[model samples]
Target: MSNMIIEQEPDDELYEHYRFEAGKGQSPLRVDKFLMNLVENATRNKIQQAAAAGNIYVNDVPVKSNYKVKANDVVRVLLSHPPFEYLLEPENIPLNVVYEDDQLLVVNKEPGMVVHPGHGNYSGTLVNALAYHFENLPLNSSERPGLVHRIDKDTSGLLVVAKTEQAMAHLTKQFADKTSEREYIALVWGNVQEDEGTVEGHIGRHIKDRMQMAVFPDGSQGKHAVTHYKVLERFGYVTLVSCKLETGRTHQIRVHMKYIGHTLFNDARYGGDAILKGTTFSKYKQFIENCFKILPRQALHAKTLGFEHPVTREFLRFDTDLPEDMQDCIEKWGIYSKSHTIEEE
Candidate 1:
């Protein structure tokens, strides 16, 4: 939401801002999220509250949080309009529901599943599934509907969805407030020295590569990111660790681990496991011997998520076991990671 806000001080002491309402041929979208798209400077939290407070209108009718909008529905607001393409459409995809109510839907996202439709993808995303399920959430917008937060495409874990404006606002506010908790499990290439530790750095886009991110201090867009981790088990050269995210950003865990000198096994983009093949982890030679032994990508999984229900206001927590491939590697390599090393340059 903070990212959506635009800072405009004053102009001629009486500033003029643009505004518009959804019209026919447009699908229904969340009122708050709608304004987020229409008004480039408005936060989802702000719009959600505004809509809840009856500041938004669909065809001159005041709608509630979950109110479904129709195509070409008039959407009126009190702010200037933006011109960013926000196109999230519904597709028929299967979803594994862990919990659902009138307020939201919590689903177990599988590995390699893209959460949103963008760039190379125009369909086959979790957003499509949500659209299909909710049949056009209160977006009243043209871009991105029924989405509050996101996980990496390759990372598997629980994702919460907002079915209504109130639910979306509460969950998003919780993320901003740092009350909702998200923890992940990773099978790193080497063992950590102590039992537990934390990684902190300012994260932003890599200056050399627009597609990738890098760690920097006092950057223009980079923000502080932190991860708390404790060892779960040890292979001579490898270790299983549990990590909790203090802040969410693109590739935060992978980048932080690589920066700290403990990259995930087989993670080619970072410090890969090639070094451990003939050295330190000699005992795991046979373990890596089998073709299916080592996992393809860096082993990381979203294991736990906890938050207070937006509708019921009751605390809820969920957990998942480690993926099988990671478990196999740990069984063979844990407890013997003597070769794992972090050489700070």
Candidate 2:
């Protein structure tokens, strides 16, 4: 099982905090062995290092890795944040910096740009551009420079980058506390009936498909997430909506929307790429295909971001226009809806 690392804090000296409770029928087991069973990608050596740092606690008492975890005992683990294993290479990529000061910078990130280097993406990320543009920025828990929060590679939006460790901590705290505001504009399949509503669920990686996130409505697994949405416009077949996040779990918006039976239009992963709604008529199918061609990715955009300035402590908000692809897709839908309704009338 993937250990749940609470995203409650970030600093130069940040740590990953996790809490686990022994089951009622759980037999006594070595703490490290018990943890190795629960925490994915964690090695015995790393757990030992944390124990050596007095970071492992059993019922408020620090314990060694070999300590036997008894039934009903609460276990808490804190490990120093691990650095990125790969060396960072600066690349001169253009950045759409909306605002900048000594303490921080606000960027209007374009879609299709990965935020950080990992796996197959070792270059051409936002971090690479930031490293080239700025001088001597601080690294966060993930070892990425300046980034406090990130949107998906296909989601365009405003992101804040801290120039200093203190700024990163402050910004991270705001996000963890849910004080920061993030609003997304999305075009979803089917006409959403409710003018506004909220989706509450736990979001985690799918057991079968590790690449996709699945919603656990019963809270049996995954991190708690909430998404509030209001309808912006309604076409006969699709609806545009604005979503506000109460939690920042990975793919929270996408998974929550899908759970509600209105997956985002053209979202290939969540079954939105096909003709999920609308008529069986060939003309309607052609129109839908044309719209999909215009917008190849999920119809979600991080349109606005609000947070307190890390140094000045003043509330700061940034908003950006939807990129051309999404705008074009919405326009096509609007025209198609008008003509289709008129023909029916």
Best by lDDT: 2
lDDT of 1 at 196: 95
lDDT of 2 by residue, 1-345 (tens): 113222222231223356788999999999989888887798999988888877787875678999999999988775555433336778999999899998899999888888876424557999999999998898776667998888777888889999988888999889899999999999999889999999999987665554478988888878889999999999878899999999998778889999999999988878999888866588778888888888988999999999998777899999999999999999998887877772362
Clashing pairs in 2: none
Q: Best candidate, TM-score-wise?
A: 2
Model 1 Cα lDDT, one tens digit per residue, 68-134: 6566665554233432433455677899888888888888887767776532444687878888878
C-alpha local distance difference test of each model? 0.66, 0.82
Which regions of candidate 1 are displaced past 4 Å? 1-87, 138-143, 218-221, 271-294, 334-345
Off by over 4 Å in 2: 1-85, 342-345
**Residue 329 displacement in candidate 1 (angstroms):** 3.2
